[model samples]
Target chain A: MIDIKNKIKEYLTKKDTKFNSIFEINKMSGGSSNEIWIIKYLDNNTENKIVFRRHYSRISEKENLYPPLSLSIESEVMAVAYKQKIPVPKIIYNVDKDHELGESFFMEFIDGITLGNKIVENRSVKLLKPNLASQCGEILGKIHSIPYQNIKDLNTSTGIDEMRKYKNIYQDYSLNIPVFNLSFKWLEKNIPPVTNKCLVHGDYRNGNIVVSSSIGIKSILDWELLHLGDRHEDLAWICVNSWRFGKIKLPVGGFGLRNDFYNAYEQSSKKKLNKESLKFWEILGTLKWGIMCLKMYDAYKSGYDRSVDRAAIGRRSSETEIDLLRLIDNEDRYE
Target chain B: MNNPPSKEELITSVIEFIENDIIDELVGQKRFHAHVAKNSLQIILRQLKLEEKNNRFEKNRLKEILKMDKDLNELNKILCQKIDYEEIDINNNDLIDHLFKTTMEKLSIDQPNYSAYLDEKTN
Candidate 1:
């Protein structure tokens, strides 16, 4: 504990001379990979709330396949997305890794349901359920339409490159998961042409968004995996069965049908949606998530982060195994 | 031998204690971890009851698919190499069937309530 309160106080006072005192600093339930804290402070006798998010430097390069986006770059991307009228948190100020506060930034806090299980199944949020899928499709369209040139240091690894990358990681694990091998084989044979490459929110799914019952989606969270890839990667990633959170039949993040989602996306993006490419990316996304789960298990076995949550996530790889089988065995149905 | 509380009973008691006594008393990340701990114990209980039969079925399937008698892990390793080297047809129905059944077995031990597993089970 680096005395986060005092550090924040120093930063705030320097940024704005009128900074009076800190009121409260509450740690929020953030992504497993980062730390999020909601800070309330008074500047000139007026109270304000902002969210502080920081990347955990403790995550060794050996433990993660791709390092998360630097906070400076993330701040830039958030600014770009905000300009494009996308639902993203407004960046307040960003500091580099060399800062005593580490690689972290403060942003406006948009409150809503960020839990996957609750957004999909909670009765209290039932009012937003009907339009959730379309809203997601529209947001994804907006995300994909952002020009990639402005973003700096974003890797533009297309589907084939990503497949090889993940394959290398899986092989490094030295675990003989035949389903993963078969899925790789399937992906190789059915790799789609990269027709469009744009800004891809690499982990856009149910849990990554803040959803309000009144306005539907308030803001999209977790841009650490930001990259440039096939537009369908964002579209298909949300449809992956693992993200569905037990509502398998309703494939659009377990909220609505694919048609509604696709129509809304097409309308917003003004680009034709290819069902075949979407199916291919969906399979790849499932495999990627499965490999990620195994990575979690590897972390546990190697005593990296021995939390029960990481250990439990390791068992989830099997869920994706069965999902991969279903997608391959019954391609017609899933597509 | 431990007569009063067997391994399964002891695990069940711990799970009960965590779920009924410990979980609700906690909040935020601690509560989340407590739930994860409870689920982990439940998975152990399921594996204790199901692993032997599941492994037997999986081994038999792998043997049929690869036409070899070997330990489960060894057979799986060979199958993986075959797929990797393109020695075996990727779309072979036997391979597909075997993978599906083996995955289902693993899911039963891991997360039986997972939607994909539940969908297949109901189907």
Candidate 2:
């Protein structure tokens, strides 16, 4: 047996924690980019269990494909979000040193189900439909309400220029996925004139959210792609059809109508929901997600962490492309 | 002559053996190795089913789009080369929809209910 127990114990001791024994250490499921472990410790009649996230080289030889800034960037965003009073797990410890558990961090293991495919099957949460969009809007409003000046560490500063930043990021990343080339060209030709900027949760959709049976949205997870950008980017992301489960009618995370979500946001944030701007953002969101899937697919093909989840994600590009087409078609009809 | 085990059967058998026999008996690196092996097997199985079809359909759709927009070879090449996040013409929604429909038709995939999506947007 490989003694990860000694390694974990040593690390805990160094962190100035008095622990007599390490009872159970098992890997947790879900996460394509990082390894997660649930570790339980016994210290003087007290038992404590905490989760650890460790970044590993997905591609054995091509260890540098995943940019160095990826993990630290995510950690920085999480810290900033935590400071802004965002509902997220309290980060207990962060270690960038490869020697200590190999690119890792320790955080309070949140006890809630990630809202993924299983969300549709879970009936208890299903009953909260009408309130779901409103709740989402309120949560998003709170996130967007964070003062831009306060979040100094967020690499990208908040401004109207964020649209240009998104365009650049998308252009660079989309080069790897051949299918999105046309979409990129189209986006270039139809770059909507930007008016407002806010803290955009780059991937604020169903998969990243956590829901509870007793409580509502426990926390928003996955800050790896967070950026300071247009507020409509987040709204459009939530309204994407791919996230709408099987019910296309219920646009906002497939839980409630779009107007309800918009009304809730307007009431909570006191900001107008610009319909034309939102339509443009929706197209962008679909293209972004679709391109992201293709990128993941390329990674899989290149033997970068051959996970079924990654492969499954790659297939979703088709759905996103479909959404993009529909959004574009709607725009044409109106014109 | 006996035929070689299909990719699906091979993956299924390996997963079953690991879950039933090796996983319970193993610990630490051995268990981790087994788990990784099982996951890799599943990934391979999915790829075997999906990759060929995905590529074939994408190529066919790209060709069709090129045919439709004759004299736009440069644009077609760019479009066929990659999928971009912010790379869509929101103003020319009809053209975008046509490309999407053509792609779907080529792939033999069912088109999403655009009207339903539109209704959601309008409401």
Candidate 3:
């Protein structure tokens, strides 16, 4: 096993001129397949912290429902977003050529609450909750408005293409989920026409953001899902019931109403929000989450990640099933 | 025959042990994982208590909607294929009602406290 701690220390010393030595290296819980470490180092006799996120090969690509964007793509998107004055972490280092460290990047860690339950519960930042919807809208507006030529490397996948991708992954599991079949059938029949594709922050929910009481969203983390897609994909994903964290009444990431979010997004992006597209993407997003849960279960079943957490997450597909039924139900249960 | 402590009782004992004894003793990641373990066991207990009744209702619903008889797994698999092939209309009232009720029963076992499930239950 490579001594990752020593490699990180050596890399920091080589990259940062003022770097002295490491103080502490703690691992933070990251995505299911990624490893994130908090590196506290002594730079010019000052203690500083940075996050080192590395995508590990613990789970292979075949196990995942959606393959994550490459770490280089993630770093590039973060750099571009930062340049555009979007609320995102600053990329300190992009390690592409390094063969040993593998696919990873070092970023300046922004401190705030990134927990979905805490954000939705409105415990610490009661004032920040109401304004979060608009802040997200504004951020997403800026993200979607990013010029196509700037992020030319991002492969654009349309809504139908995305639906087909998830459906293919679902079939790969070969598990018969009636609700999932209904959702796929409904999405196939009601798939929205391909709109103008832009930089879509594929996962832009409350959990992926760092929020403070003072500054609403300090930085947007987790750009692994970044892709070129319809702007409504970003907008509707936040409204998915799974991200609401039990605060389903408040649809916009369980923070504020959709009207505020749409108005703010409209003001920022100068694009009218389409209700039909948003609704379609919302259902699609829910089904995607459900399939993702099944993927987690597959990981456990396949013995790639045999943790209790993953096993329990398999049961969570039912949550998305109820949410999907609610969304597709013509009685307007989504209201 | 198995003795005084039934399967549900055994699970309840473990959950109480975790809640009252083990969880507080541990900190940080260990405690968090202990909670997850307890929750997983609770889910199993809920499934044990509810699966038979839920399956019976689900099978009855499937029989009514599909107008045919089969075992639960076979019927569910058939329902999925029928939905896939567009044999049953997505907007059919009986189908929708069946899906809704089945999902609710599932949530009762999987996550009883889920917000949408609770909302639907109260409604």
Candidate 4:
């Protein structure tokens, strides 16, 4: 790779003169929007483990055009959410422009499985399945309860804005996805009323968090799309078909019942949830994720990144399309 | 174009080789990469075996529903444009049926193991 260890060591030495050596730096796989390296360094005969997250510069122009937020913004959001009793990685250090590794930050590495399939797979993390769904709802409640006024200036998005944005992304790919159009039409005709505004974790799915088989959700990761929007969006997103990891019958993250999830949210936030709005955002989240798959395809087709992961993800758009058909035909709601 | 080893046979052989040879020796990241390679080969096989039949089925359905003959891509583009302009008869059974069947057909190759695909197939 780029020998990032030397740069990290140099930067650490400046922050503290004792950090004179790097013990080991392992590049964690499954990197997408950012380059994540789990690093071990020695400072004053003491060893420390930290996750080094830095922006990947070689992303295609289309993917970069959206989401103008910086890593510092993510750090700030994490800090805010942590204060509100949300389980999140501790912000070790927020990198400034003076550091040579470009825009990056450090967080205390939390140990847990993050793979969606393993999170609820029978042979894997099946122990976590019993309590994860309700625990997920409670976590989202804590996040959504964070006051809108506190984080509104963070360049976030609202429901209508997100709808328009999803449309741009869908059309931007230049692929003929008729199912997307059908969903878009339905969303256009059925825009739910903006009852209130709150902090919405734009990507609150199974793979986006760290979960232990015993403790449930340890850290809610991936706040790159953290925004001020419908609180229901966060609740609905975890229920998307792909997020369920094949336990399609269980609507809430493929483990627990939806009724239990709703009860947990109502208990934690102490607020009555608007079910209709939740359904609206659920549809929106499905459409957005579907478009995200196509975005990966576009990235690969245009000679940006040629990872097999991207190519495989490109084929998953049909999964979203099938999910959309299920949703639009009203079978999803009954299930 | 039919050679000694047919396209399907070659694809299957390559996939089996990757699964038995390279994948077993790999660990961690290399193992994951090998898994991806295996899936990719399987996807290619699926596309080769099913794409023609799927395309013909879709084209026939589109022709019957829209009452016109056009290239497959062109027909799909037309359907999307019609939806964009709100000209689609959303409640029509024929249109929804076409969408459902086409999606399931694609998933039969794309992700036959996907839960929804199995659920639909069961029904």
Chain A, model 4: TM? 0.90
Question: Which 10 consecutive positions of candidate 4 chain A have the poorest summed lDDT?
Answer: A122-131
| Residues A1-335 of candidate 1: C-alpha lDDT, one tens digit per residue | 68877787788779876554667888766565677888887756778788889876477887876866677777788889999999999998887778899978989978788889888886655556448888888888898888768667877879898899899999898999999999999899898966868888888998998988777889999988888888888899999988888777778887667887998999999999887788889999999999989887888889997899988998989989988888888864543
Worst 10 residues of 1 chain A by lDDT: A121-130
Q: Distance (Å) between predicted and true CA of A152, model 2?
A: 4.0
TM-score of 4: 0.92
B37-110: candidate 3 lDDT, tens digit per residue: 99999999999989999999999999998889999999999999999999999999999999999999999999
- The true-structure Cα RMSD of candidate 2 reads 7.2
lDDT tens readout by residue for model 2, A42-148: 76768877777775434352323223335555666677667877777778778767664666777776777775656655677767754667778887887777666
- Model no. 4, DockQ: 0.81
Comparison by lDDT, 1 against 4, better one: 1
- Overall lDDT per candidate, in order of appearance: 0.86, 0.63, 0.86, 0.80
Task: Give the better candidate number (1 or 3) by DockQ.
Answer: 3
User: What range of 10 consecutive residues in model 2 chain A has the weakest lDDT sum?
Assistant: A59-68
DockQ of each: 0.91, 0.21, 0.92, 0.81
The regions of model 1 sitting more than 4 angstroms off are A17-19, A42-47, A96-98, A123-130, A332-335
Candidate 2 docking classification:
incorrect
Highest DockQ: give the candidate number. 3
Tens digits of lDDT, candidate 2, B6-104: 768978998899889988899865687677666656656666676567555555555564444333345455554433433433344444544654445
